[model samples]
Target: MLRCSHVLCKVDDIAAVVRDYRDLGFTVEWGSAPGRAHNALLWFGSGPFIEFFELPPVFGLLRHPFGLVHGGPAGERLARWARPGEGWRDLALETDDTDLARARSALRTAGLPVSRVIRGRRTRPDGARVRYQYLASRPAGLPFVVSAYDPPQRPARVVHANGARAVARVRMGVAPADRARYAALVGEDRWLSAVPAATTGVLDVELEGLSGPLDPRKLHGALLAAAREERG
Candidate 1:
């Protein structure tokens, strides 16, 4: 089953997002930009890491190819109508199938359309190169997007923030109709829902943080700042 991947916050400072996550006790990591604006990946504790991406092309590449707007409010909008966690976002699965082609076929037969597969370079701190693949093509404003990754040189955790053991859940605000469809996509039995407009941000996810207590407000502010930086 696919689990939540880190939520994307469309921002204008790739660096500030890193700082914000770092301030929250999460280890934020950076790699050389694939191009254009910077992309920062933050590993909060174990397996779940949020990636902040700048630039429209990069964001579009990761999300739904056929974009649509599903909303809770009229005035709030962001880049190509793909606001934070809005639309059919991606959730990754730890599959026995690492070969992307096999996984894509399975998803297609399951009913989720394969949008596109992205192949790129990821680098480690020591400058080692890692081949990266991201799979997508789910419709917009739906509940979940699915992705699979393979690291050619280093482990996926190496380029991404490490420490998170497993993703617990991701909460986002969406129209009631949209939410229901999404829940169905994720398999209703495993997904949860709340009243429409109950939550504020586009997406909210929980990571199995390290032992001890971590404050949600602190993490929220850091995430906001990073989003702002992406804009500026």
Candidate 2:
């Protein structure tokens, strides 16, 4: 079973993007991973967080060993397909198995178009190290799943000014004709939902916000739209 670990929003300037989300009432943090890229993590208590990546100007022109471009070299191929400006670019899934080889095999057997497993690591300012393995697929807009080889300790709870508690659901927009194809890729996950979109990629996300309901689209950027999901 796969659950959303986080969503990756590609942007040019990390600081500006952070400021935008902060104004929306989310607590965004700055961090970088080795030479990969810089990021801002939008914390929503538990469950999944939103990871925004600030890609380098030479990203597309560079030859990334991993094939696709976002997460690492493996994403080079996928990155080439991404457009400029801020928008949802990648969606990561969490899995129980931590073995990279087994994880790759499982996806292949299940018929997902996944690339070879790629290793990645990052060290926090406090000296904490995060290690994980992931596989990127060219299909379905370069979505990937990763298993933590060494997971980081959970951080303290954050008080959201907008009242968002957790991510309720991620709404991805797909071409009308490719709806079934994308749906099959997403499998049968309850938390992740897909709708026919005029364009393909992440349309919007729903969150459990405190100040009633919220949509990221109403905040800014059409690449990702957000809504508040009611909790029982």
Candidate 3:
């Protein structure tokens, strides 16, 4: 089954962004390879976390033979989208199934774009190894699929001062006209949902915290809006 794994936030400065989140009582860790886009990860217990990264300035200008640039097409697109300011950019879904062929077949049957599963790996500063398979979406705004071969263990740093526990749900804002298209893209998933609103991107995310519900936006404006919406 598809589960909302995390959300990607593109920013202009990693250090500043990390500080902003840290001030909000959330543990942030720097985790980016040299020569690539700078990034930091925020762990939200056992549920979805947030990934913040900054695209290289020259990303859009460079073009590759495969129609990609410095950080590939996704990076280029994110660079453009974040030009206005930092906010929600990408959503990720997780599944236990590691069979790419079967996953592709299922997505294709649902009439969704299915790219060849690509393998990815990264090593943590403490010598932990991480590996996963990624499947890019067609429209680019929808959540991408990530199947982890060796999912990282929930660290002791999962606790937060803000009383936040886990990501409850994600709501995507879309134009009324494109509702059907976006709905089909998301399918009928419980952890993920969409609604017609003034915007056409990630609307808000809900978090289960000790103080009931918390919206990340209240803590940081640049941090995309995240709030709990009744799932009925």
Candidate 4:
């Protein structure tokens, strides 16, 4: 079964985004190195971290190549439809294996839009390398599938100043015709709750914590809230 991996937010400034999120009690990590720095990861240490990134000024000059890959090209499809200031672009559902063919087959049989597999890899800040692959469709705002080629290097748990634990709710605004497809993508993970919309995209994300809602404007249009009780 596939589970929500992580969500992407297109932003213009990594520094500002980090500052804003930290001010809001989150432990935001800059996921890129200097000079070519273009992203930050909102790591909750568990399920679904949030990735806030921006395309290069000269992104048009980049190329998308075939076969196993490293860096920029692989992420080209992710940023293709996103604008710098737009929040909550695509939601990725994940599998434990690197080959997404099985997942793609299921999606297709279920009548969901599934693209050919694309693989990628990158080194983490600690120098650990990670490999992954995913399936995506060209639809403007639909969820996608991703899988790790090897064991994931991300932390299994973390302490958030805000007392966050998990993603409690993802309120999605989806197209009526694609409702079933979206439903078939996830299992009993009730994180996603959908409402019909003129278009398909994330409407809000409710994190499992004890804080109030955030200002969507600061979040580039993603309406996020922390709404879970702290356990003793």
lDDT of each: 0.45, 0.65, 0.64, 0.69
In model 3, what lDDT does residue 3 have? 72
lDDT of 4 by residue, 1-232 (tens): 8877788877777788877877777777767553456778777757777888776545633434421242332344544534445677778778887788888788778776555777767666666676888777545376777896465656656776767667777877889876666667665565677889998888777778745556555675556776534322
Clashes of each: 19, 16, 3, 0
Runs with alpha carbons beyond 4 Å of true place in candidate 1:
33-37, 56-96, 143-148, 152-168, 174-181, 188-202, 207-232
lDDT of 1 by residue, 1-232 (tens): 5554455545545565566556655656565643433666655434445666555443444332222322211111223334443122323333333445665566667666554444556566666665555454334444333334444221345322323444455555656545544554455323233336642234545444233344544453222222121223
Task: Provide the TM-score for each candidate, comma-separated.
Answer: 0.58, 0.79, 0.76, 0.80
Tens digits of per-residue lDDT for model 3, 1-232: 6777787777777777777777766778777543343788878757788788776656654434223422243443444444545667778877876555566667778877656666777776566777777776555566777785576545766777867777777777777755665676666766567876764567666666644333455334343333534322
Q: Sorted by lDDT, highest first, which candidate order results?
A: 4, 2, 3, 1
| Model 1, C-alpha of 102: deviation from truth (Å) | 2.3
Q: In angstroms, give how far residue 206 of model 1 lies from its true place.
A: 3.6
Candidate 4's C-alpha runs over 4 A off are: 56-80, 212-218, 228-232
Stretches of candidate 2 exceeding 4 Å from the true structure: 33-37, 63-65, 68-82, 140-142, 176-181, 210-232
TM-score of 4: 0.80
Better of 1 and 4 by lDDT: 4
In candidate 3, the residue pairs with backbone N, CA or C atoms under 3 Å apart (3 or more residues apart, or in different chains) clash, namely: 205-226, 205-227, 206-227
